[model samples]
Target: MSTTALSSSSTGSTGQPPPRRKAPRRPKPAPGTQRISPLRVIGLTVVWLFTAFNLLVLYWLIMAAFKTPLEIFREPLSLPATLFERGTPFRNFVYAWESAEFGTAFLNTVILVAVCSVVIVLVSAPAAYALSRLGVRGSGPMTAFIAIGMGVPFQTVIIPLFIAMSEIDLNNNLFGLALIYVALSLPFTVFLLTGFFRSLPDELEEAASIDGASATRTFWSIMLPLARGGLITALILNAIGLWNETLLAIVFLQENANFTLARALFTFYNAASYQSEYGGLLAGVAIIVLPMLVMYILLARRIITGLTLGAGK
Candidate 1:
């Protein structure tokens, strides 16, 4: 009944404190309701349509590969009867391989691509590591010069390269083509690997140095293992490009026996058109494309990962 009682009586009519005010509540949005832009909807529709069209085209190509030439045009969208009434479903493949010279061309391409890819990686990796990590003088300018080569058009050098190869008696020779590939591939390979090497941590090299490891030994033992992804990426890129390369093969290779898969396919297309053997033509096309397609599908994830490895830095 002292000061507390007097204050409570002054604040409210009774001894009790005034009622507390309730806070307002917000209404929740309806489930499954979302705002979307019309532009986004249109873009998604277009992309899905394009993807469907590509898949349809692939299906048609596969179906046509098993059909006769007449059936291919007449029943473009229909399934091949070969699937159900087949003696050997791969007759077209066999014909293309044996008669079209695809088998020999396939062998030549494998050897050339394998040798060239390895040589390109071997030559470029060390150069890239040196430019990126070693304290070499004029490394920046050298790297710029090397990068500049990538922009130079191969067309401009064709005449001179042909002349040079002819003078060396290497024209139409696989060895000469391999040399050109290695040389042309260097600029891009070195440039790409340099950035990847730069993105790697410097602490590893420092630790190796502290343990009395020489630069060469450290690179071979430590850095090389870390850079395997980049190297493999470079190798696969070169191999795929070289596999599908036609211009160089057309210009450099004259002998049918020396032809690559791409060159052979070109030749087969012409011959098959004249003979009305579209099935064999598609078979040759599949032969040229399938290996690269399979490889890409298998290594698609690895390739993407490798390309993105140093992107953050």
Candidate 2:
């Protein structure tokens, strides 16, 4: 070959080439760059305003709890002039406590809430289990029928329930209130628990069966333990519901001596005497709400766990 041709061939074989490169991708707009829809903005603003209004009401109630009647009337929206003022705040609470027979009411409420919660858990858990796991006839229809109870307003049944309670001589009794609470709470409790039970895998039950366990044993031993979160959630919800129930309690518990904290609050308003003790009434409301707040704070983790567990499945 000619020297120039040889050199050209050698250069072709060994010449350095430019590195391969990717085409530049356009930079993504930051997440917030997308314009929010006007409707969504309005919805969010409305939600925030609603939340703020509720929080303000709660704040007003709490502040009013410590105010004197004079302070409350003078500045309904303002903070107490002197929350620590001797005699006024303390005396109001004491007078309210004595006048309303709060000691008896408190005890009655505690017993009613506790008994009703237990009864609800007991009845609903089994009903839910049967509806979820058992191949019982009409289970679907039964479940639907029970859920339909939620849509029916309590007002429609209150008179009938009152008559029935009276027939049984259960009116004006704590046990009567407990029984009513259980019935009222059952529909939602059963619905939530049925969903929870259905979400549980059947492998555990199958395994227990293979080991010669009875159905009841499998449910009580294996299934119930696995469903602790759901049970806790049911208990918490029922407890709160029963604790705050007023209308049924007021109707069934007619006597002053049988009054609940909820019913006692109404005693502050006497149209006959025109004696509405606003400060004491607000204080009573605060007292009634305190237990619910404490309960939520205590059981918030379990509630979150149960709700998330049920939702995920």
After TM-score superposition, the amount by which residue 31's alpha carbon in candidate 1 deviates from its true location, in angstroms, is: 25
Q: Could you give candidate 1's per-residue lDDT for residues 104-172 as a string of tens digits?
A: 898999999999999999999999999999989999999999999999999899999999999999989
Whole-model lDDT, model 2: 0.82
- Give one digit per residue, the lDDT tens place, for model 2 in 1-313: 8997777776675574445699999998665455876666887899999999988888888888788777877887897767575645465577667777788888878877887898899899989999989878999999999999999999899999989988999998878877888888899999889989999998988899899999889889989988888998999988887778788877888787778888776664452125656676666777789889888989898998898887777
RMSD of 1: 5.6
Predictions in order: lDDT: 0.89, 0.82
Q: Go through the candidates in order and give the clash count of each.
A: 0, 0
Candidate 2: how large is its RMSD?
Answer: 5.1
TM-score of 2: 0.84
Residue 203, model 2, lDDT? 91
